[model samples]
Target: MCPVQLDGIGPLARFSRRSFLRYSAAASVVASVPILTEAHLARAQRNTLPKNIPPGAVRIDANENPLGPCSGACSTISGLIPEGGRYDFDLTEKLEKTFCEMEGFKPGYVMAYAGSSEPLHYTVLAFTSKDRPYVTADPGYEAGMYAAKVNGAKVLMVPLTKDYAHDVKAMVAADPNAGVFYICNPNNPTGTITKYEDIEYAVANKPKGSVVLIDEAYIHFSDASPSFDLVKADKDVIILRTFSKLYGMAGVRCGLAIGRPDLLAKLQLYGMNPLPIMAVAAATTSLQVQELVPQRKKINADIRQETFEWLAASNYKFTPSQTNCFMLDTGRSGKEVLAAMQKKNVYIGRVWPSWPTYVRITVGSHTDMEKFRAAYTDVMNSSTAGLEPMPLPRRLRETPFTHLS
Candidate 1:
């Protein structure tokens, strides 16, 4: 596979004075509406778990990094506990500055949030509307779809190509007035990548006034190139980065939105809460560790490859994933397998409606995968006679974005 280049994208010049003035005017009304975030989405995903989880359960759900924050990040966060009382907004600015300098982007083009989900929601709220539909791949990350629901925008779920890559051309032609085209590179659920040229094609051919939202949450785990070059060229693109996956900071909650200043300003209209101090400190220190990304990438890749090999030897079908997760096809109903695995204390990922027979599996530590394999094999051979799949979440219908327990 051709690797996506990762070299620094050259610095982008600041937006015009007029654009900054306009953004300043719009920033006044901090988002009064409560928006759905990734935490809420995670809760929705967790609805699949049993009422009571026993101790020592092998949990490979949620695609979380088993290796927690690096030593430097832990120390930096620990050292900042005393000053937690004060809202060190300057630390956020410094964090933003550190990331901007590293990525060759102007400081004004980036904004730090608790996690990328905030900006993801804000982007849909800012760009999409009832008439201007939201376009995304079916079985892609569902966070944006929920955000679109909040905005009362119609969602167009284009099916991924036969190869499991985003059908960029179909997405472009899905709706002529699409407000936002969301792409999750190394897509969630299915860890397959849509090519860089296809992304460029979407940028070039997408409807006018529509922005292409690229979620690179799992980019570090994949060999694909980052989309910073589009932002550097002043395109209508916003790229989201997070410390959750590879950096092992999901609970710490630090992420960023990279785009043109004018584009980022639209997100500011949603909200501007100060970031968590510990998250900022940890993220800053993590960025400074130059060797952190490659080292962790190898760890995840090796484990994932080992698991894939086992699945092949056992004649189990799965996507050729390049990241921390992949979709596995259970010969029977995926929900039955999920429930049976849960009984064995080996909880896996949820099932997507588009592919009822396929369940997403997060690549965990080698030991975790070994247990998963044991549980999975036993479940496959045993009869699922009385097993019942977890009930579909009805709370979403009751109230969109309501936290599901």
Candidate 2:
């Protein structure tokens, strides 16, 4: 990892003399800085619900692929169980090789992890500090912000554009000495795509030495193009990918961080360990199935669209989402509606503070969504006069369910 250096007009210039010294000291031993731990992964990925949910509940709360892994991946995982005794680091290398070849990325440019959350946290920890703030969209994914908190970095939240896209221009201006500008394409909660031009603008115009981190965890579910060219050009950019979404490997846990070798090396400053061997085999086999991405994309798109159409026809308000999840505006407090839905055995996503009346809903299987439609309609029509809003302190508190937020 490259150490921070003092220059006349460099990134450290914005810091006071004392702050700069502290940041430099922090950077010197960054490898020892603890960030989000194993427990954080679950919170970053989904809003936790009650543990006693019936097994048959329509679980559309977490943005998981109900389709599970493809047949090939399942078979590969099953066949590899006996070999689990060994670390089988070779399997990880093969998986990385398979992905690098397919994506046209140089071998060193991509680092595999158990899930995207680890790299996401590491990237934030490596880039942001007390001197350099972490810039992100309000009501966006909160995992990076959690890392920023640990690093003592100020988290500057730029509100989304009127259409719910990341306000890249606003983000660029949010902190002149920003360390990492994060954009989650087809943004979470809203699931709306920021224009590719806007992303390019952030890259070209961002402060020198600052990295533009793009979390493309939902890219496969949308028609949005990947930002591989930015990494290829050796720009200060990092792209995060995960099998947890469209690959239906949320439980399997395989992901990648793609960027210039120097940029990726910074993330390695935290730590690197052997990935789950079964995850590697499953991811490798999944990649070989030529039809996987498109087929699963279609499945998610179809189900999401069907849900959107129902919401529209029923005159309910919702964002025009292109991914497997979308924000739904409940005429009342979203927290109330979410609880009511849960009572009906339909668990949905949590509400973002910026959009208190908007509850996020993950697109589940056709049958799951059908139940959601019925339960949602019933909840909206029924009385919730005494259903109080989630308290501010509780909403922002660091719980196992909401630590990321």
Q: Backbone clashes in each candidate structure, one number apiece?
A: 2, 0
TM-score of each: 0.88, 0.87
> Which consecutive 10 residues in model 2 have the weakest lDDT in total?
396-405
Q: How do the residues 1-405 of candidate 1 rate in per-residue lDDT, one tens digit apiece?
A: 011111222213354566556545545322323445534543454434554446898867788898989999999999999999989988998898998898898658888989898889889888998889898897788878866876778888888888999899999998899999999998997999989999999999999999999999999999888899999999999999999999999889999999988888668656667788999889999999999999999999999999999999999999988899999999778877887888788878877767888988989998999999999999999986667655646635443321111
Q: Write the per-residue lDDT of candidate 2 for residues 1-405, one digit (tens) a residue.
A: 122233333433576676467555646655444444322332332323434447888878778888899999999989989988889878888888888899897778888898898888888888888899899997888768767876778888888888889889888988789999999997986899998889999999999889999999999989887898999999999999998899999889989899988788667646557788999889989889999999988888888888888889999999989999999999888878877776787878877777889988989999999999999888888986665533434324552222112
- Looking at model 1, which ten-residue stretch has the lowest summed lDDT? 1-10
Q: After superposing candidate 1 on the true structure, give the runs of residues whose Cα lies further than 4 Å from its correct spot.
A: 1-53, 397-405
How much RMSD separates candidate 1 from the native structure?
7.2
Candidate 2 ranges beyond 4 A from true positions: 1-52, 388-405
lDDT of 1 at 367: 93
Residue 356 lDDT, candidate 2, scale 0-100 = 87
